[model samples]
Target: MNGTWLTVLMAVPLVGAAVLAVLPRRIDGNLAKQVALGVSLVTLVLGAVLAFSFEPGGGYQFTVEVDWISAFGAHFALGLDGIGLALVLMTVILAPVVILASWNDADPVDAAVAPGRSPRWSTHSFFAWVLALEGLAIGVFAATDVFLFYVLFEATLIPIYFLIGGFGGPERAKAALKFLIYSLAGGLIMLASVVGLYVVSADSSFGPTYLLSELQQVDIATDVGRWLFLGFFIAFAIKAPMFPVHTWLPDAAAQGTPGTSVLLVSILDKIGTFGMIRFCLTLFPEASEWATPVVVVLALISIVYGALMAIGQDNIPRLIAFTSVSHFGFIVLGIFVMNSYGGSGATLYMFNHGLSTAALFLVTGYLIKRRGSAQISDFGGVEKVAPILAGILLFAGLSSLGLPGLSPFVSEFLVIVGSWQYAIWVAVIAVTGIIWAALYILLMYQRTMTGPTRPEVAGMSDLKVREIVALAPVLVLILGLGLFPKPLLDVINPAVEDTLVFVDGASVEPVATAVDDATAEEGDN
Candidate 1:
């Protein structure tokens, strides 16, 4: 059973998806939501069981391998390290919450629209796609074979495409098409790298292999490795939606339902940064180091540029989307720094960002549903009408800005500290983004929640019980991790140390005493 847990974890939602696909038309949407929620909950429980049983320093647990393509050296290999386990837990935890958040979207809001443009989707089908996506996303995080990972990577786009196109705003078709084009292009580019990896391995005494462990051992020339690294990095960069390639995200998130946005931005986008750590750095260490200077500059640009764009946005969802770009910059910075502190911070940031971003999107969805608009100007004096909702919004917004007592603050500080170890100037520039963060988050809050009640919003209601239930888990995690991050850090630090060993085998120097001495000198003067 221990050996098979990962398979069962992936199988639950997939089986549930299949069940929902064949259910009779007479089956109600509420029933479908119930079934989906149940399956996701069971998966979450299974993930928890696995987590408790997991040894903190275990490299990769519950590994199950079987031959798929003997000639190509690909296998149906699945395992979980601390990093993968954390992400798998995130996906499962968010699945049921997303379903609950999207409960109202199961029905058509405006049935009078033309048949082809109708925004409504059958609840059963909608939940099915969501469940299938949950399964695929978990598989992506857990896959140990490069080919299997790429397969899951491309497969995830299908469910999300439908989730956006079928259930989103009027421009959903265009948004969906844009997402598909960008994602497919990236995946295709990565496929070239995958093939190159196989060729390189075949040329080696190790022979051809797509298993990540074996692939790591086969060495290619510096020039070829750099090219191969770019193939993978560009794909991940596009997926990470870093800077110029990030345009599609604002559109897709603004157009899609909140739950859809949560799945896309919060969980799915993580694959990009996650891959940069797991594959790019691990398999091509020298190339990773070679590319670090340019990559770090790009990350800095994303941090500053994303914050500026977010500050100017009038649409709530789009604003949130841009903020994510900035956050991802921080994550990328930590990873590329290639030190234990930076690496660990980036991994923890992945988990924390997912929780905080989901809360923002869902809370924004609630506000939009109540106000009947997504425009910032449409929301004024929201706190007066719905204080609890406003309070949640404030907490989430503050967390986004890295308030000292929140989960994001811990990870953000770790990233800065880690980046400083690698390069102080990079850390200093990245710190400026925090100022920009405060501007966007606080300004957005002031404009939307504090002004005189807009006439249209005067009669709006507060969050319902189900909505609170959806949010409670995230809020609890936000606070719990903020106050006591040691548990998760303990799990994450060992894995990050291992990754750093694989990437550069360099040790981090202690900077705390230097900082303390500087502070003491200033105080003495």
Candidate 2:
């Protein structure tokens, strides 16, 4: 049962999707939603069981492999390291929440009778895509073979493309096309690297292998390795949606339904940073080191630039999207810093950001559903009418801003502390983004929640039971992890230590002690 857990995790959602797709044409939207949510809940429970059963100090647990294409060395391989487990857990956790948040997003009656309605898309199909995406995302996180990973990575675009195009906002088509083009371009580039890796493997003593573990052992010359690294890194950076390639995210977030945006930003985009840690650093250590200088600069630019953009946005969904860009900068910085604190912090940041971002998106979506607007200017004094909703928004917003006693703060602090060891100036500059975060979050809160009640917002209702149920788990996690991160950190630190060893980077030192030792030696001299 333990050996098959990974397969079961990936299969359950897919099977549920199949069940939803084959259900009778007249099935209730509520029934479809219930089925989807139930499947997601089951997957979440399986994820929890996997986490508990996992051995903390072990490198990768529950690994299963069977040859799928013997000639190409591609196998149906799955495994979970501490980092992978965290991400898979996040994916499973968010699935039911997304289903609940979008419960009415695909109502058949609404589409049939609403003004200017298009009756083409079905509620069943929408739920099916959501479940399919959950399955594919699990596969992406659990895959141990590079070829298998790439396949799952690219396959994810399909369901999300439909989710954005079929069930999204007014500009859904344009946003979907942009997302597809950008993703396909990146995937194509990554495909070249994948093929190049195969070529390199064939030429080496370890011939024709795409297994990540085996590839990590095979050596390549510096010149070839650098090019291969770029091929892989560029794809990841775009998906990380870092700096220059990030323009698509705001547009996509604004156009998709909040649930769609949540999955896109929270779960799918994580593959980028996850790949950087699992593949780029582990496989091409020297190339990773060589790229650090440029990568770190871009990371700083993303941190400041994304925050500044987020601060200026009037659209709530787009604002949340830009904030993620800034947050991702911190994650990328931690990964590149190549020490235990930074690496573990970055991995943990991915998990924390997913919850925080999902909460923001879902709550804002609820607000939009009631207000019929996504613009910040259209909202004022919402707290008076929807205090519970406003409070949740404030909590999620503060978490996004890395407020103390929140999950993000711990990860953000660790990233800063770790980077300070790697380079003091980089850490110093990255710290400035925190100020920007406070500005954007507080400003958004003030304009939307604290101002005098608008004529339009006066009669708005607070969160219903369903909405509260949807958000409660994420909120608990944000607070729980913030107050005591030891459980997660215990699982993450060993993996971080192993990664640093592979990259030949140093372990974290106590910053205060290091400074004290230096000062004492200077005084003695």
TM-score of each model, paired residue for residue: 0.95, 0.95
All candidates' lDDT scores? 0.89, 0.90
Candidate 1 lDDT over 212-318, as tens digits, reads 88888887799999999999999999999798789899999988889999999989999999999899988999999999999999999999999999999999999
How close to the true structure is residue 211 of candidate 2, measured as C-alpha lDDT? 90
lDDT of 1: 0.89
Best by lDDT: 2
